[model samples]
Target: MKHPAFFKQFLITICLTFFLAPNLEAQTKRIKRPKSSVGISSVDNYVRNSFDLYDKVYKYDGYAAAGTPLDDDDIDVLEDALDDLALISESAPDILSSLDGQNAFKKAKATLQINKANKALKYSVKTAKELLAGEREREKDDDDSSESNENSDEESDKNINNDNSNDDGEEEPSNVSDGLEVYSKYDFVPGDKILFFDDFSQDFVGDLPSKWNTNGSGAIVKLNKVEGNWFELKAGYRLYVIPDINELPEDYTIEFDVLTSGLSNQTSSGARLHIVLSDTNAFSNGKTHYAAVTLPLGQYAAFNINAYNHFNGKGGMINSGLTADIRDEVKNQPHIAISVTKKRYRLWVNEVKYVDIPRFIEELDVLNYLKFHLYGLKDGEERVFIKNIKVAEGGVDLRRKLLREGKISTNGILFDSGSANIQPQSLGIVRQISQVLMQDESIKLNIIGHTDSDGSDEANLKLSKDRAAAVKEALVNIYNISADRLTTDGKGETQPVGDNGTTDGKALNRRVEFVKTQR
Candidate 1:
């Protein structure tokens, strides 16, 4: 069939464009397996292929009419694939480090470079810049392999599991902040009521975090080669807001787990994270009244109030001295706990005390808002990820609360899920109460157990009873408290202190209480 002259010309042009478009053709084609480099580790080869695929999708092709413009849907699909590759590249180094070979150094260098290449393909100009810059700074960070830390997955997991069992064969106490045995050095206690809690489990991958409000952008992401989900900050000067800090109790605790993305060779730079409390609902662009705790790379975590800076000023030095030294291994995540009671503030990182302030809040002021900030970021400064954030109230004067309130309730005494056996992590609080009981030998008490409104009522009641009894047994056998001095009871779900529907609320309702008995 004969076609119009212009139509014929258009058809010929289209054919030439498709034939000459090398980059666009590569993007549309199935990923090609690159020839294996001599002596390249399997992990390194995989990383190289992934980065190569990313380059084909994002790099420009020479032909002017070589590619069709991607629609929003197309962009989204490509971006998702890019994200997967980026995460895999991020964790490839750690996996490579786990291997034993002379090629380890070569693999590590290749792995680091591939990660940089992945970052270079990032879609946004700003985000791409921040991520790429972070990679650049991490060059020195890649020097120390995870092996140098002497912490292998086998060893770290073993430690996490046996945190309760000690070599001495004696039951050591647990940490007050988190339900882990080795954290016995921690003296933190959660508040009586849980104000806010989030694990990021409810959020979908590659979506905004469900439990937070941020002025900038962030996403709930799980590293392709790592365990757990994290809220990754995607921009600078971003504020991560917890919407529930309406009227915080004077005595409360905040806890979360965090890791920096730029953990390379035992050195970290350009990553700064801070927690702030202010009177405003949203953090403003300009100055406002606020108190904050800042953690800078390679230094002690500092606390700042208004104009007084803990690490830089004399007034700041009075309350600052928590050597965080967040280096050695980037993936070795740390748990942070901050407890506040009236004017006093104490913070714990992992099992060690980072700061202790007897009088941080000087007046009748209450921190009505809570926010997290990331700043001082340079071109390769690492990105920070946080998860399992919880804020609880009531840490000061436990004995006073028990006596004055007639009952002292605690979430510290934890048990295995659906089991009556008390976790070894609960020993810390039990020991504390035992010492108090010993100091006042004449005092008689009743231990009561409660559960959230879940499962069958009968089952919950029985679980609660068994848990109460377990607590009593621990006090009697482990602490040598007289059985005659303590009585046990269970309320099950009938006496709930928090909403049954929410995770934090359910955690709150499942607790043990000590009631003073009139002997």
Candidate 2:
């Protein structure tokens, strides 16, 4: 207590020291030096720096600036510049800032130059594509001109033939007009439920189809002149296999579109397509027994069936007698339809019945794998394209379907190729319906006709109506069914059950339906 002011000063100093000492220690601990020796900058700043570099490197900005003309040789130069720019941009983050911003500026310039080079490359590629497309189109035009010239010659030949008409001066019937006559009495229909269908719309060009495999090289290729992807079979005797999708029912149908090109002419003497069905999952396995239908293509085409059937607990090869050659229907694209009813197999090319095997397979369950084999290939002289492969389960009881659902839709009743005249074989299906009607006297039916989207709407509608009336007439005249109990109507190519772009869909669309008016 000698001096009060001294004591107060000493107290203040002690308090200040207590607070300041801890704060200074904490501040020193909180400050951290970056692990790397190089100074770091924000990502925003880094990007901005790169932008500045890009502006400096490329004198011009943007891709579309009119640059110097480029040829194929310039592709390499532009590609190299692109690569260097990419490397510089990748390495820019690691550069030390102590040196002048030369490296950063260079990187920014590269970025801009890279962008410009990309634009130039794209333009060059586009130009190349356009030139190639033009060349193809010109080639197609030349081919078309040649075809037109050949047609003119054919017309001249026809005119000569017309002069030498019948004894009564009637002009000779042209093959084009008489083509549909071959399809008369052609009654081929698909099965009931579709099991598998593929148009190859999902497939990638220049690659093998994911859904199909072949022992020989086959690729999904687009015809420059044609629409859609086609399964291009490379060479002879190769099995283009659609591996087992589902077990075959007792009654099933298989339909596909086949385009046989590379033929010398429409009547060229080389064309054979063998469609085989095997019992095993894999066709290549030794244990598999197969039944095949061989169809020769072009004019004068004949068909035969060969089956290795398991008879008496053992297998033996059975071949059917060759059929009479129907003028080869495979000119451009032909729809091939085959119906399998237990042991029997019937095949139709377009609308003409090609083969009817009463006993093709011994058992229905013995069939699983389906494949197409190209035969009669003369040293890579021919090419085959197949699309729209559809398989469906068969055996629909018409009476049952009508009774259960109040309506029965059928593809079984077929007509002449482009006419309303019902095929003679279609009477069998009508007979079944008549029997049902006879057993149930109170049943009344509305017979409806449908057509595929292959023709004009007005024509299709007229054809459908005529066909429905024809069915009614057949039921009344041939089957002795009551005219009063039945009514007829037509819906032409309007309501479709399947894709119109496909052959199977067209087949399904072309059908006769029976709707129950009263039961």
Candidate 3:
């Protein structure tokens, strides 16, 4: 017969052991290794190789570099590798959650980092090559100019001495380096087709295909389908149309098929396909910043974009000139390819490369508006058929090629309290954010403040708002970010990033986020 106190204590211990044992076991299970390996092959191997390449390249040069002579082939390879690595990295949380041993996954991630580094290295080499080529060309031109001057001086002296001046004595200087051209020739593996033409059978908001919106003509996109495909409005001409405004590398390739019926003489105006860079929505009225390609009914042209000082009226959209002639070619069957690198923009008709525009524009201001459809002038019934559209980024170096071009930063501060005041210890974090913002004037940000579910809804909302405002004030008053450029919002407890029950969950929930809003 055991004492009553001892028996009660034993019972309590049994109950706790029964309930808490599985939880501890579950935690251990979460970290366990998977039985089957996520094999390293094909793109995985490429990633590994990329990391090795980056290590070697960076060892030679302190900073990563960009690729030279941008072309389709190399762009494809680099983009494919980036896509793979991005997919893998994005899926990491899910994989870790399901697996018992997450150590292997970490190893895989290590491999991915290496691959990214290598891609950067490749780009750096490309950029170096371009610089070297440009330098050599300049040197050669200087030499030729010197020789021509010497000849002219000799001829002038002779004329003065003999009094026999002849116009025929002047000779046209030969362009010795005329044929010296560099072309990027690396080929990329074709990417998996993520988008289908059928998917756009209905109009919708940016990126989200399921969320439908009425078209510019107050008609739903689903009702405007022809031959099982929805009619897509030209990028610039349509009042409301889906725009492909995604961030892209400085050197990349864009290819698509355009099917169009010949334009009607009365209403046949060409549409503009714009590649803009800034933070604003290009489709909105009076958008100021963008770089674009205007494809007329029978012609193509390029433009350099800028914005007016004031936001009251439509900003500048200055047209450069017609790049090529396409009058002989009818619409609806032609495959068009536009390839851009750090040096030039090249256009291709069908498979034949035609227009090679030299690198006139260095950095387009509005990179966010990379893709758009320009509408033709005629309204009766001109349709452009698009198919097999592809985008790719190329080069060998990973860090320089993808990460640097992407401009992704991983430095920021996280707070545990939901109050608006900046804690004394968090001064360093505030300074870091301010410094980065100051350094990149072109950079814009979305500052979001969040809170855990500990206080009343109204109080939390105000607190979050106050916190975001506090951060914004600090940035503006202390750091000097223009009030107009910075957009601040407080979501309060409405957007809890993690669970509210656990301590770690609460920690993650009470946070502020700064997302780069501009290119």
Tens-digit lDDT string for candidate 2 (45-138) = 3333333333322322111122222333333333344444465456544543323443443333334333333433333333223222221012
- Model 1 lDDT per residue over 1-519, tens place: 222463344445544544554433222221222211212334444545565555444332212224443333433444455566566556655654534563433333444434443443342232222222221112232224323322343343334334433343323322112223343334566565677877676789888877677777778888742345788865365555444567777778887777666634333244557677665666542134455676654322222222122221223333354544544212446667788777777776666666776766554354666777776554345567787787877665577676678678897676655667564434657766777788888888899999988789998998899899988887887678999999999988999888888878888899999998987
Preferred candidate (TM-score higher): 2 or 3: 2
Model 1 regions lying over 4 Å from their true place: 1-185, 221-230, 259-262, 284-286, 296-321, 324-333, 375-384, 412-428, 456-459, 473-484, 487-489, 517-519
Which candidate tops TM-score? 1
Per-structure clash totals for the candidates: 16, 7, 52
Candidate 3 per-residue lDDT, tens place, 258-290, comes to: 445545444333353333333455444325444
Ranking by TM-score: 1, 2, 3
What Cα-based lDDT does every candidate model obtain? 0.58, 0.57, 0.42
Q: What range of 10 consecutive residues in model 2 has the weakest lDDT sum?
A: 27-36
lDDT of 2: 0.57
List the candidate 3 regions with Cα displacement exceeding 4 Å: 1-231, 234-240, 265-279, 284-288, 298-319, 364-366, 395-519
- Residue 228, candidate 3: alpha-carbon lDDT: 24
Q: Cα deviation of 389 in candidate 3 (Å)? A: 3.3
